[model samples]
Target chain A: MSRVHDMGGRYGDGAVNPADNATFAQDWHARALALTLAAGALGQWNIDVSRHARETLSPKDYSRFSYYEKWLAGLADMLVNLGVLTREELKAGHATGVSELASRILKADAVAGVLAKGSPYTRDGAPNAEFKPGDRVKTRRPAHNIQVAGGHTRLPGYASGLIGEVVLLHGAHVLPDSNAHGLGEAAEPLYAVAFAARDVWGDEAGAWDEVVLDLWQSYLEPTA
Target chain B: MHFRAGQTRATSANLAAMPHDHDHDHPHTLLPPEPALRVRALETILTEKGLIDPAALDEIIETYQHKIGPQNGAKVVARIWSDPTFRKGMLDEPMPLLEELEFYGRQGEHMVIVENTPEVHNVVVCTLCSCYPWPLLGIPPGWYKSDAYRSRVVREPRKVLAEFGVDVPDDKKVRVWDSTAEVRYLVVPERPEGTEGMDEDALAALVTRDSMIGTGLALRPEA
Candidate 1:
């Protein structure tokens, strides 16, 4: 829940640190790989379900539905295939107690552990950056094409070395870009910043233009 | 009914405006565009199969082409220019205030507004897909939707902006924002100078749709 680092990778020092060798030291990389593979599998499942749904439903109706709703439908099919949930049970639940069943099934804790092996859940020490609002900073561009298994790099082509003002700091988190996109390990100290159009584009940039980017702490370095 | 009739007339006129270059040395180029043929075939199949009623397709086209798009952005610009406090509120949390206006669509509930200042310029792109601030700006422009624009803009923004006729000095940095989540973005272009005495409506009139998308600035009133 916290925005820990900006590099979109997890790195910290502490007791039971997820990134460290103490707790998950032995199986950390393996867990990360497995989780990455699982994510890819789930992504494929989502694509399949969405394609089928698109074929069956109108675009308007499909747009109105949430990703979670589609996931639940897909989950039902998967559960039925595994013989974990019978069609009769699913039908009965949908008929009379949809809300209750959904609430119980969708609890965060239930699925939290499933991805713990790959998640950045370290109890590491707090971040070091003293960045405040109005401070000028530049995003650290990660190496070009430096691929990591199951992690995404926080180095977006658009964000590299761009000056921005720190807006809000979302405490330590697994940088979504790196973790989900297979760029790098999850890190800490994520801050969302707003960039002025002029700062980004110069005088020719419409004086009124600006953009806000969510950056992991590691991706930023104080600018002169 | 009048609007529907007008739409048909306008569509036909636009179609007629296309260059009538029927002859081509290359047979491949001479063939009708593949996408056009695919669309025609799909329409025939859908009609024959009764998969979608004719009225539904008409409604869809009308909603997207006429009902949705740049007007929504224009309205937002007008409101922001008219009300300074609303502009502040928009900068604070674009989603909540936007929802208050009740002008939201799909993928708009999580919205963020980035402002462009005299010293900085901002542009947005989605490398993975053509993610845009549809709720505020409506559909993205044709250039934003193109793969070349998407792939190159994020990497070489200065060069790309030059292509769009926005020349940034070498000293000025070009920052590109990538939308990765369901959240959408709108660029709040800075209010231009020399418009101090102008009324809010007049100032609003200066705010162009492209300004909201971070591609250009609002036009200033001539002296």
Candidate 2:
């Protein structure tokens, strides 16, 4: 679905401010990051789901909110929707003395261990890779009314429905679209699909430049 | 009267050094005036409910802020630059080498290192959200997440690079790696000229965060 988050190929936003590298400019920003990570570390919602929640914000709010602030809003939304925290609790800014259902909180000492042993999206699967490096391919046209249906996707708006060459075959990895919707790990072969600037953005792009996207096998079709 | 170049530089430097000169704006002021208080309230409530551990929260903050950052990746790049065998290992299978050096896991789990040669320059951007290799590059810079970059980098990488003062030759192919999947990419920037006698540590000093992102060239030592 078209959203503020999907801004690829669109123009006239503003100059890329190169000097703004500070991770957290305010005290609340750090708290926002911490709360999101802590709440997410629980074995409840998936990363894709959290991302979808973040994208679901009104375009006005999404545009206005800073990166961590967006995370805070999304985290709050997810908690409320999941029935873990009530709206009253959020408004009151305190727990309502109700029993909490959070069973697997990330322990302080184990934070480093857990982060060091990161989440790998790959899963052992049966589908063999359909394409190899050097194979010519075209991206599948994304379904237009996806936002109305309500879900998540890794497919960028710009390179969808475009032709490209397979540069590398990443072995079976979890499909984020399915994972976001609580579907089973629909693992599939992923590829680094390279599209020429001309092919992606017409004559405006540099003649020699190319953009490569890591596309799943399901997002591609064979081409001569 | 026209000011000299030195005076102009001094004036600009003085202006930059001045604090709270005109605008002392905090974005949080627009949303809620008491965000810090609100955050503190949430933290206290969550802690009381046992939903979050304060120590764990501190640990997470510390890791991203200090423990891991661009310097870790810089070491890896410097090693690769100084040693051909290491470079071959990195190009062939980078995951193991990065893991051996403890730069694996988190966003750095599934890794691919793209080399920058004289003929081709490699740049990385996540057209989606900022899905960078946190363990390798630390948290991504703010501009990386800006709409201008997310929208324009793919269509005008040369223009973007020019803004960063990196002028890729027109003849050289510019390959923009859009990180769309879980696998993260790290660009092994080409070593700058006139640093042949420098050690790996010295070479590491030349590696800036932007060079790894392909926005800027590696620093050149004094000739």
Candidate 3:
């Protein structure tokens, strides 16, 4: 088994410089445009009405709004601005019956143009070079540059290079490295795996001490 | 912008000593108090521009901040502590079990309750964003929102807990729940000792907001 080591460095140290960070932010802003288009094209508001109640108006109404909402909201705002639908139409459709209105909007060429551009969602992270569940694997301790309050650096104070097994695939999420820089960057495939106590801390661990973590696919390497 | 190697070393030492505190007076700086503020500002603009009725904005702000989140959490906690079958139901299939409670928060239709025991510890974070089990634990804490906690907690559970003054023994395995999507997590912390005979209300009282969020354990009567 290869020993995973965390060569200490700053968060966002390897992937992004200050310049790349700016670019990432700009990319996120641009992506917001596409997200709005997709939402409009899909008649997301109507979908919300059917799923939630009439009282639930904006998708933002959903509690626990996060970074994703910004993109969706920007998308909706653009749709209204593009003359795809009058704000009144969107609002009225939200109240009662809007299937016909939604159908018309969904068919609009302008709306189609925006949707055709497709999603600005990007995949930006290390590629996973490991196998699926039941495969024995170990976590690699790559030196990560993390930004702290007053400054930024990398340290291995945490459980770095701990061994575990892949349990579930968590699709793609915004890479932590991209997020630290406020770049509004893309997501990567992540996994949820359970690590046995003995593997992580040897005999010191309790019999039931099993650690579960969501690791980026890139952070893993297959064990022989 | 010069990265002095020695300065970096000193900073790490300082962080180790101080262990970043979340009790900053400026709470809003940690999480966006902006959503509410922005809603208000939008309402004001709309009102001035005659875009919306005055009452509409007020309702929006009220529903989101006060009515939506904490109420959901309280209901879920109450339901689990009171009903045994429901407790088992929750442990078995958390998502459907949560719906039976009939108190759903935004993004909380899907839920998971991770059990925390004497031997094992659990904590939740939304590394990419602040995804929390709002239906079961209420709005997340400021520390949960801080980039330091989000990035470090999943990777370094013990160190992160230590910063929060929660020193789990090295023998105890820490499970960090990384919430994404609509799925959220609530920590079913071990029901503290001394409260074995306490009523549901008393037990609920002992279940501090932090315990629900998985930071600290539920309170027990002093020995």
Candidate 4:
């Protein structure tokens, strides 16, 4: 189902705010960012799982809360679901005396190094790529009945079900849709698929413009 | 932005549960008044549970805040401007060329640096999500994540560029790169004219975060 987070090609009420960027506006924003990285370093849940937590939030909460606030909410929910913490503890905003499971902990000293050596999504010994540059392919659309309730998917909502030309085959890599759900590292070929603006958004788009998107093998098929 | 019946109920229940004000009319103006207090609570709870280390949190923040940012990208762009071979190498094998500058990891894992020439202008947006090159650009700006930017940029690149004060001529073609996967993009902005004698450091100073994102152009040096 389409969520507020999937607002691609969706019109908004006002003009796009072109204000300058700020790293963090509020102190809590920094805390939200830090806690996310620290918890992510524990090696329990993958980044996709974290994303799913946020995606499943009540659409109301999803749009109302700011970006980092969403991060906090997702982190809290995952902690409970993973048995790291309980719902009671989260509501109370403090740890209960009862002990919880602890498999691994990211130490303070290792934080910098851990983050510095970021987790690469690429996997080893993957199969050869199916499509190459200059190949014409069509984007695969998810079946209407298909539901992605609690998992992750790299397939963007807007780019789906369209025709495009393969621009570059980025050597086989881990499929994020599978990796995000703890479904093991299912490696596959990724490609940069370039679609003519008219093909994606109709004739309203500029004739000279093209939108290039990086897509996984599963999302494409040879265009007849 | 339509919601299901279940979602509607969930929202109502959530709103009722929280002892907070709701400004449904204007969500943009909504800011949690007591964010610091809530952050402290969450941090305290996690620390006590041994799920996270406070020191580690500090280090992570410090690194993103001070160490990594657009300055690092400016260095790469500067090298490209100064060394023709390096620029060619970037267009051919981006990962290896960028790694030479130690600018590879995180969102910067697989990059394709698009050069802006006299006839074409390039811009980037992750219509799906905020898939920016963090190692090179640092954290993305809030507008980059807004629905307006994500939706309109691909549809009307020329108009969006104008809003950023970047006006491409009618003859110039606009290319929008939508980052949909691990591969990221960094726009190699056109080198400003009248800066023919600037050193590498001086050239690096002209590259801003927005320039690399293709929303703005490189700054012209003082005459």
Chain A TM-score for each candidate, in the given order? 0.41, 0.93, 0.37, 0.91
Poorly placed runs, candidate 3 (over 4 Å): A1-163, A167-191, A195-224, B1-57, B70-83
lDDT of predicted model 3: 0.45
Clashing pairs in 3: A5-A141, A9-A154, A10-A145, A10-A146, A11-A145, A11-A146, A36-A75, A63-B106
**Candidate 1 residue lDDT tens string, A23-96:** 11222222222222222222222222222222222233223433222223223333333233344544333222
Candidate 2 residue-wise lDDT, A172-192, digit = tens: 987767665555557899899
* Candidate 3 C-alpha lDDT tens digits along A1-224: 11111211114312111122121133333233223333333432221111111112232232244333343433234234333334554343322223333332222234323222222222446455356766666665643433323221112223357667786664564444333233233355666667774565566544555556566555566777
Task: Report the CA-based lDDT of candidate 4 relative to the real structure.
Answer: 0.73
Q: How large a fraction of the reference contact set does each model reproduce?
A: 0.02, 0.52, 0.05, 0.45
Cα displacement (Å) at residue B69, model 1: 1.9
RMSD to truth, every model: 19.4, 12.4, 16.2, 7.0
**Which portions of model 4 miss their true places by more than 4 Å?**
A97-103, A143-151, B1-34
DockQ of each: 0.02, 0.23, 0.06, 0.29
Descending-lDDT candidate ranking: 2, 4, 1, 3
- Predicted complex 1: DockQ: 0.02
TM-scores, one per candidate? 0.49, 0.89, 0.50, 0.88
Instruction: Label model 3 with its docking quality class.
Output: incorrect
Model 3 per-residue lDDT at A64: 40
Residue by residue across B1-223, what tens digits does model 3's lDDT show?
Answer: 0111122211223223321222232111222244434333322332333333434323333333455454455445655767789888887676566555555534464556777877778887665445565445444544555445665555455666666567898667677665533345677767766665666666666666666666766666662
Say which candidate scores most in TM-score: 2
lDDT of 1 by residue, B26-62 (tens): 1112212332332333233323322223443443333
User: Candidate 4 - CAPRI tier?
Assistant: acceptable
The second chain of candidate 4 has a TM-score of 0.81
